[model samples]
Target chain A: MSKDKWNDEEIGHWLKSVPKPEDNRSRDDILARLKADPRLRDKQPSRSRKWIPAGVAAAALLAAGILIPSLMDGGGEVSVSDSASESADDAAQTTSESFQSGRSIEQNSAASDEEMSLRSDQSVMEKGLMGAAVYPEAMEGFVPFRIGLVHEATVVPVTFLIPESVVAEDFGSVSPGDAELYNRYASQIDEEALGFDDYHPYQGTVSTDKGGVTLVLSGDHPYDTASASITTFAESVQETFRNEENVLVRDESGAPAEFDQVGALPEIATEPEGVYFAYEKNDGTTVLAPDRRFDPAHAAEAIELMKSRTTDLFEPLIPAEADLIVELPAEGDRMTIRFEEPFDFSRMDDQDAARMIDGIALTAAQYHLRVRLQNAVNPPAGYQLEDVLPLPAGPNGIILSLPG
Target chain B: MDESVFHRIYEEYHQDVYRFLIYLTKDRMLSEDLLHEVYVRVLKSFGNFQGKSSERTWLFSIARNVAFDHFRRSSVRRKRTDESFDWETEQPADRGLTPEEAAVHGDDMDRLFKVLDDCTEDQRMVLIMRFLQELSIAETAEVLGWTEAKVKTTQHRAVKKARELLEGMDGWGGGGR
Candidate 1:
């Protein structure tokens, strides 16, 4: 045996030091330990509303809304097709003309301010809550928290919720294949508040001299296309509006209403006052109630309060003791529960996965909490835990608010 | 065979399983724990054992996969925890050298581990079974579901790469092998 090599001797010495097996513990004990440790069960992806943009990007591409095709290839950077700029302008003009015609706006060059205001009000009334009327002032408040969006470029409805306060800034022709249009929309929203289950309010569309996209506002999910109305403006206005601060309150009719209220249901704590409450069963998967008027500066503080206050209500029924620290950038927390000295996931089939996902989802739903399926950030298998349901464009997970 | 066949097999071959793990990880306690795990696995799959490789070879192969899986999981956890745990530090040094000299020789092994870790599970399995487990080229081919010629060619490349690493060093073994 060579001294330098890791021959049988070195290995034998190391093996002798390991713990002796008792063979005493029953199978149930091992299973119990595993079940009690969330870390042991390969972590399913955490769900969040952040993925709405990506979903929207996919949806837009699928909807034939924009026909941008992949340009990059195996070679170096793709050269911009010279026809891109001219064709893009042409496409923008066509989309604008169609949208304007659909809304039946007059082609007159000189419309009175009163007429414009009356048309804006009429547009809001036509879509009802399906439209979010964003004014110029209301949009200014939410701009700082805006993150861009990713949506299916094809299916992305060209509609948006404009608080009555927003003023359009500039209306210029778009570069036909600019990928950032969706990205810009996604990045500009408060993702935590407007995730898979919540509405992601957008800043007004980049208007153009071709024909400006109109802002429709009343209080509701921004992706509610049926509620939006289009308009053409010779000059663009910067849209601004206040973010809805109250939870949604419903009238006797049971449709989601736009109003300021004390809270949602009487069972949970009261929804804060002065804020408008809008309750929605986001695409039939998650129920969320977001305040259209949130102040971004207070969001982190608000998140902490909500997390601590609702901890007990949303705790799991099986009561696991694994470390539950939310993952930070580089910190590592791991838990490994043994399975009778022979762990085999190959035996676990789809039925097992469904049962596990269902149990977790049902337990979460009890507290009115919706778990958004986030892909595994890292692990044994990097896989998406759940498919994002195809929704027109809305937040993806359960939305909740704190009591005043 | 009856369940007692598995119990008897475990009693007879548990040490060989432990020894196989020891060669792979070079950590005695970890190897023992893994050895026990292998036997437990064998106990579960005893009925499925079709006698393809001899009982000993089959047990060794299972032990190898388990050890490899453990290392992969450990390294992933370590990486996630410290974003900077260098896996090169875990390699063993070469013999026939003093402590300081061995450290220098250890660099080759470090690069070897890095290359091995980066390989796909299928490729890595073939490499380890041949060199580290000291399996014959044919034995490695059988265990990994590969042809004998493929195993030989891959092992030759693996050895050449290891020699290349050694050649890059000062006072190295050169490429005589």
Candidate 2:
């Protein structure tokens, strides 16, 4: 047997030489395995069912053949994908991709035919995510949050939905400090207020650079009209936000001490509604007001000043109106704002813009709606929100940047 | 091609796969379990395979990975490492000489196998796949993702080492040829 680069004759001989099993009993045994494991028959196109017969063919060859052929039973070099099963175990330790690569099924010594069959009968969903699923009903009683980053390290206000009958004491597991603060401010919360069902306090983080405050509502009512009462309450809160004074919830420690006031805009208007003052200083920036008693006139003035600013800096860089549209095709839950024009964000520094962008994002959380701000064209130079986000450009926008 | 085709494939390949596992892991039960697991996986992913390499080379590669993976997942490994043998627990040697292992037949072959065990896994694999498995140079190279030069060089070293081991054996390959 000369071996000179394995000619056609050698390959054919090699192919024909592999051993075939001597009995039909083994074939019957494997078929019984297939019958037992219904997963093999569950889907025909999948590799599981597809290769069973191929395996049987290889088995048949060995059972019937006289020669040992190659000590290895593999017919040829299997491609990576074909060999995926062999490496499935290794895949877990190697590349993340191969965990699902069940190309080869090793025979089991401890596995009973019954166990194999039962596994195949089980649905994939039954297996669950990493073996466990988060219960949906539990989510109902808990506050739903999509907590994420706000500017460098600050977190957006965490909104809480307080049930009408609940008092600060009913809040189980709430930190003692929070309990103390709630107790100190108990008088402000009207337990019997009619619109208390949807009462929520807009809670934001507080620190030297960033601090948090909560906009709370107080009231108490019976269990009878909870659902409808809650819905109406939510609407009333929104209406109050739009038409009343600019709410301010001040942290006990006050704003960050290091702010360098470049200039002070007059003391916030007496009847400020939508307008909230935010100051930037050397240490970091802080929002002037969070949730406070509503003032419609002051809000109108602040919103007017904010709307008049320009954003031409990074026009092309900003996501276009077509792209920025959230929950496309007219899904109703949205924070609708009519912009004067499309904003050009190109002018503002990227980092500052990201910061300013957080303001709009924070606003969105409060409203529980997706907000987008469009920028105006031919905007004034240096008329950008400093240390925050760039002005947005588009029709019907919600600007996140500070008033220029 | 058909059910019969698969039946033939399994019967033919199962033992070879088992043998490969046995040799690689040196654990009979682990090798059997992995052999079945490899076949099951092969059945599942067979359709995705494109005919780039021969099925045999592909199968061995699979067996190799399965064995390695089993090695990783087994908690038994920690026990093996922890349970060190005490030198005092040895049986007294028998006075008489024992016959050569019937499996190897020749003393030289037995020495060669011992030397094969002493070789690095990579060297052992190259030699086994080449001489024992009788894979072509190109085939072995493809299976291990090694260049042909590396496989040949390693094979040379392995055989040389085996010869060195053989020289110390009693028969010594018929009195050193």
Candidate 3:
């Protein structure tokens, strides 16, 4: 079986020997999936049945093979025009193609599917960014502005993509830096609209120089009301400007600002530690937070712990219905998650599934590991199933204030 | 749209496209996802598929685009994060199977499969389309959005590369020891 070179005939023989695996789904199963795809729901015949409004929390549901056509409002790797799935892939596309023409289901007798490419199921919407995390694959032509927004007790890091068009129109040609992001749009956010309490447009000028970020607070700033208030402010600052090593808080005179409880603040190190779990509040704000009492021995433990509630406050990222088998490589940074067969990911709420995937990736990052998901019904966008995927740029993805 | 027409077109071509995607992505789950996408797009734009080309060829082209789009997005993301990772130049561990997998698929098949994974994307695609899926040079060109000459050239190189690597393997019996 050894030779300096094999012949073409032999190569063809071997190539022909390569196995052809059959899709396990029946035609009925496939048709059901196609019909249930909220992305294609308009093309479906109107029947006296429940139809999930496209992208109504259905962003990442197109790995859809089993769910009866429900609703779609979230984005995953599955894009649905611009108004379709709020997927990272959609966000990465040229910023003008919106796919909200489902109402007409126009007779494009002359238009070919090639016209839209295969991007129908994967566009970024202004609505819900399905899982709200920037997989490494998101934002190619766009710049990502990642910042931590304060939500009462937690610091939530979210990403906004600034399209090139906006960059060109607003800043001439060059993309602006992350430091400028907070200054430009921090005050513009209606924190309550984004499910966070009113916090931004901090009562100060934040400048990042070689000495680190300098917070020149206006005298009337109420950050010194109590110890808890100062702590929240410090944590928010730390989370927001995690890139800088030292943060200095000063009064308008540029001297160290004093609080009644903590006195003058020292030069702060910008570091946020520990992993996060999806926590839902009584008011319905579901953000990622770390349990004050729960700490794991390692990343594997953290990932396992994240599957279920660590406390009453924290909800699991991975759903209870998925009886997934996770295999951590004894060495190396790749984790393998094998799902039990007959699992239809589209059946779960898109937001839940997305958070679960992001939560797993974020947890794996605690040990510098990337997850390689296996045997998923429809693994959402922001994941490359064959490759070990890195964690999303940040959690709670938002496209707020695409600065122009 | 009548479901029967879709069923017929699907019955004929879904397996071939699925096989092609499996060969291209080398992951069953991913292939399934891409397969769904292909049909989803196909069904949505089915009215416009005017038989300008044969249904098989059109379907193959759609399938190729679906696969290509997936790869392009993935590679684009990688390039952003890891400066050194260039999709055009990256040799991959796409289908490297474990001992259990090799035993299940047979050592020779697994070896060939793994070796094929290392081939350049163009060459690998040409070889799979030309030989395994049995698309002609013309159809392969159409699917790849390339010319027939490029298809022939890539098919030749893909086969040569695979053969050259296999000659050095221990149990490959194709070259007539």
Candidate 4:
């Protein structure tokens, strides 16, 4: 459109002229597809009926746990334990009653839906715990202490949740080796007390710095080799110190290791839940590992951090060399990713490309956002997404099999 | 929605949805597939449709999602040995002349689309919605889930970029005017 300066009116006129191909298919084709969609079928009654009892059963099981504590404490008002047990019992009773009444069909259906949603949430959490070999014997009374992985410049923290029994008052008074030993024992209890499946003693040195803690790991294996345990310990030590600015994980030489190193002291703060990292295992299966500190709110920023390839466990699907530029929608549920020159995907084999896309998609999916690749080269067969790119469903579809 | 209601919606909006997908994908075959997927989603989720947005806006939003899903799924599929695959290859020859060629053949509309391909996806989306779809800034923002300011800024930038691209083309002299 010709104008002194191009305007919206002219642009609109020009755009309207773009050829819109004819749709030869009749309305019958669409009606046929709609009919074929099983989701539109009349299966709600059966599905809703199945979940009602399941919800009741779950609530009863929870009530059973509550009953145990009250029964153990016995009947005495003066006993603090007895009062705590009574309150737990009351809460459980309320929950059970709520599940029992299905006054209206709509209300019943809604309750059933809530139960199904809760079950799905539990499954996701269990999947998130896939790689972790939890030592329930040691962790019985321990509460999760979350430590933020603060990126110094932006003060954006990725929090890691660690289980701990007691918080240490002083790290300065103890030797580095002693502090490590004390923290490990305090968190996991005495080695002799631990069951066979409990995690082993620390194989790393811990030292305190100015408002920060430094971990000098001695093991030959990378941090990711025992990612769940190593990260759990790192989080615990950070939690123990009150003035921790950052937690630094280091090699023996005292220099920052390329992967999962450079721990500063703690600046312990909690963010809203739903923090996750996309990490690939040795077996090549990529899994979404949830962290209390990995905030999804800073997903755009977190995605940029992933590009640095900082963690041993997590790798960026988009190659490190690629110049990634992202545009996040104002609502924050969708993102547009553009890669500049040297971001070639044409040379990658099908598996590598799929892995790359999976990493990007899984990370974005954690935040409930879909990603569109703006300038991706060599998209897979049957896909031509130079424009209007959409993310596929995340690989969370694969059922996570926990390590035996 | 019931089949009869869905049939009415299909009759009312299918052409617009199909056209939008065609513009976004530049592949008629793929756009056709996405059009069906969009309706399938619409059919499944119709009960949840609160009428908070216009039917047209909702349909376009669904179309956009369907197209993106197509890109994602296609990217993950095992590679085929299509030696003919080339990133720079012009729009399929069977699809008829590209906008640039159409512009040379005295089609002003094609010329605009040719210039549009040079803009970023966000810019292009804003331009298409605001101009060709003739959606108001508020409507465009609503459909895109972007702020009105974002829509305005993106529209401004898109026009500037398209002007630059057009200026560079041979025999360009405000053909639309």
Candidate 5:
């Protein structure tokens, strides 16, 4: 009864007195309603239907990568008497040649420059090929054409290829005007390359305005590639549509993205390049190597990859047993690395600590990121980094350095 | 969910769900409508019930979301109307209470509901789940997607506010019934 404070017992007693309505509906009425209720039907199966288009788009893109090169080579016109099997063989041959040229350039570049080269030999291979004017006439307006380097591997080079026929009907479904544009672009493409091919390059709609050519990369094209690949793809697209003063690239969501040229793209690093993992040299000095499989663009992902015990090829400098929690700032490019428990460096010598710092700093630097160590006791001399410490130029500073 | 299993669940928890919705919305017809919707959603998502929480807590959580959705829809409707609507002034269904029955129980019960309606939605939910439904702090937290500490804090605040509201009532100054 006290007004100042009411306990749970008093509150319960008062709430128990609140009146409620009696259920007047018959069991039959409830059952009937339940049977008719649409939500009660199996809806989970329908949820997966949304992903079908994406799967189709991915398949179409893969097919385009194989078929587009040959189609472009033949000038987009196929002979009516040519068997489907023969056309398939030609496409397979073109794909092989393109891949071979890419590999040869990569091998030549690696041999020429011992340092890791930012620009792969794919650019040289592209230069050898005819310009974007080689885009077949069948694909001009009907298909979305994007020419860029694809980053499928650390050292391997692949060209960006689009398969536009997969979603041409979807574009044409939008309006008659879009159909007209598709025809105009289709006619404008280099039709002499391949005859009326089933697959055309370009996945989304392409339109040119007073500003420049805008290519909306629609459906499932290029989103699965690395950040570097997306940038390369955009650059290639810009190169192909070079006459336009500006080339605006939009993702499937219709949001304008500059990849990494002017702004950051959404974390599209399905496979990013230049991931660093710690390895030890013969002299017991720890070194870092760019791990191709595990490219971590952020500090937390990098720390997780680091925590995975290394194989014989690489060694971990940070104590494998130490649980590190990393917090990345939302607005700025700073990362804070905190240990689950206070990290004791008294057991570690200064050189070992310095090696760990180098490994951490170089891993962050791969993403153009920075790190701040929290609750690190006895960090190495001149390396007690507090907040927002700039990453070292390279990892394993004593034994190895990054290429300038 | 299998039809037989779904029927059994509906039979077991429908009343409790109906009561909770009534407490939340105060309108019996709206509560009944939302109760049906809650069960419909439960049937659709029953396979995803990972058994991390008790069936009762999960059902109450669904009920809470359905009630909030109703509130959102009604608020949008209310925006179009010229006249203002006051929750305190809206009378709940009498359920055929006689003049004599009303005279005996209506005043204090009405006042209690009015005070409850005055509380913030989060505070009201915490108080109702913790006290009226006799859910534990952990259960309340799970249902509301909140921390146990947050549940305790909101419960404390809600009780304090209810006491203040009761004390302000005419001729009801710190005295038991």
Candidate 6:
């Protein structure tokens, strides 16, 4: 092995050994940066509009397009103009000249503009509805009174919708986001009255950034008693944050959260498990719950699994007298469940029926099936059950709009 | 473009492009900044994509252009003439000690990249796309807008240059595999 005569094949193999660098920033972070750039927006075609709210996008345009162009106009450390000045014989654009532009005039410090717009992107996100975490469209204009309710050992999430009118009373037109709402109302939520385990305003600091929520759990945070507790805590977080996809669980000192049994956990990815069933809170309040650990075989098996009481933890969503048959769609993805007797959801409480509908729809969703409930058409969550019901955006929704 | 479509493209290609930018710039913050530029340009001009090249190659082309633009804008132009850009991208940023650098300190790769720094821009691009990214010779040619022969020639020269540089250092002693 002569060092002097090392071959190309050896070099090629060693180059492959250079490990691919880790990219930690989430998709949301990149999107935030994209939304923050005005050049993209200025060139955006009209048909592609309205994905983001007009107000947020306008604010983004203002921050990126305005307020900082002159500040960076040749005023920064020398990266652009001074360096390229030495190159007197800069060649013609032989490659990708279509994307290229005049060096000096076009170099308006776009990189510096990026840092500015990223800081403003947070303000853009905070302007979105506080309850966008659960269902953005349905919960917009209402602040969330979210509580992580305990049902047996399961953490059942319940969000009370705080109407904008009520928010304006104290905060005056500027509705406080999750942190403020948590601070102001969390202590007062009667957990015993709500039938929860008194876990309100999580014993942690919840903050937001370009990459979704960062939950800083306290030293004695109570989320990690078991795998069930971990699942619920993490899932409950999904229901609580604006963007559930990127919840980073940090310790008190901001290191990635490490639980007692589970050695080290960096972040929580909230994915729906198999068939959801009914569970009752400590105060006998019923909520749709999923056995997050269980993996049901298929849609039919899930339907069967949902009917029988799994344990003291999970109860049957379907009534004991009700008998239903899972009817697979001929060509489409929607599963049809036809009921024989006691299938009338009209007899159940409106909210209970809603939860049942939600649970069934959610179970169907786990197997990539949309549910078209044949007999339960007029179930109480306000959507027409006669139609093919898509998966519920979430579970256990209860709005608490302040009275006028 | 639909945000969902943009998001899909971003998810699929963002990591590879980010790593490519990091290898080009060696500074995480600058890579991120350049990544932003790449994505912004991508989203703006995505409608123009003709689908002639694979989506991966298309993204790499855009990323290579973005890195080149950053060099043109930044002080990297001072090291060489317009035709030959001697990439002076030394000293990875302290903020993000990439897992690659942290895990492979004093390894062959550490020395390889150091030697690669002395290679020309064309050679660097060919070596990265061909070997690091595992793209074929034709795909690397598509990204750099060069003929396959040119890509092969550059790759050969780049590897030989890297070996020669490594041979000069006392400790290299010619690695076995």
Best by lDDT: 3
Mind giving the per-residue lDDT tens digits that candidate 5 earns over A127-207? 111111111222222233322221111111112222233334435454323223443433322211211111123567677
Model 3 residue A305 distance off true place after TM-score fit, in angstroms: 2.8
lDDT of 3 at B147: 91
C-alpha RMSD over true interface residues, model 1:
17.3
> Per-model C-alpha lDDT, please?
0.31, 0.34, 0.58, 0.46, 0.49, 0.56
> Between 3 and 5, whose TM-score is larger?
3
Candidate 2, which CAPRI tier? incorrect
Worst lDDT run of 10 residues, candidate 2 chain A, spans: A59-68
Which portions of model 3 miss their true places by more than 4 Å?
Answer: A1-131, A172-175, A281-297, A308-310, A319-350, A366-368, A374-384, A401-404, B1-177
- lDDT score of residue B12 within candidate 3: 89
Model 3 lDDT, residue A219, Cα? 96
DockQ score for candidate 6: 0.18
Q: Is candidate 1 or candidate 6 better by TM-score?
A: 6
| DockQ for all candidate structures vs. native | 0.02, 0.01, 0.21, 0.16, 0.14, 0.18
For model 1, the superposed segments whose C-alpha errors exceed 4 Å read A1-404, B1-12, B86-127, B131-138, B145-149, B165-177
Scored by TM against the true chain B, the candidates give 0.61, 0.72, 0.82, 0.77, 0.80, 0.76
Weakest lDDT window of 10 consecutive positions for candidate 6 chain A: A87-96
Kindly report which residue stretches of model 5 are placed more than 4 angstroms away from their true locations once superposed.
A1-8, A42-174, A177-404, B73-109, B172-177
Residue-by-residue lDDT tens digits, candidate 3, B1-177 = 457667887878888888887776666656776787777667756776787788888888878766765564455434434645455566545324434333334455566566677688788888778888898888888777789988888887887788767875644454542
**At residue B61, what lDDT does model 6 achieve?**
80
lDDT of 1 by residue, B1-177 (tens): 134654576567655565455445544545545654554456545666798687767777677656754554445334534655434454322212234322322433444444454454445566566555557777777666579999877766655553443334322433332
Error of 1 at A259 (Å): 55
lDDT of 2 by residue, A1-404 (tens): 22223443433343234332122236566556444432234333323321222212111000000111111132222112222223222222221222133221121111221211212222221100010001121122222221111211111122221211222244456532332333333223221111111122223321111222233322222111212122222222332232223223232344321111112111111121222223221122222222221222222222333322111111121223312322311554444333445555546543233333433433333333344454433222222222222122111110010001
Kindly report the interface RMSD of candidate 6, rounded to 1 decimal: 17.4
List, residue by residue over A240-349, the lDDT tens digit for candidate 1: 11122221223334443322211122111111211111122212111112221122222222222222211111212111322222211122221112222232323443
Instruction: Please provide, for model 3 over A44-159, each residue's C-alpha lDDT reduced to its tens digit, 9 standing for 90 to 100.
Output: 23221221223221122121111101122222223344432333334323111222222110111112212212232343332343334455544444456666665543556656
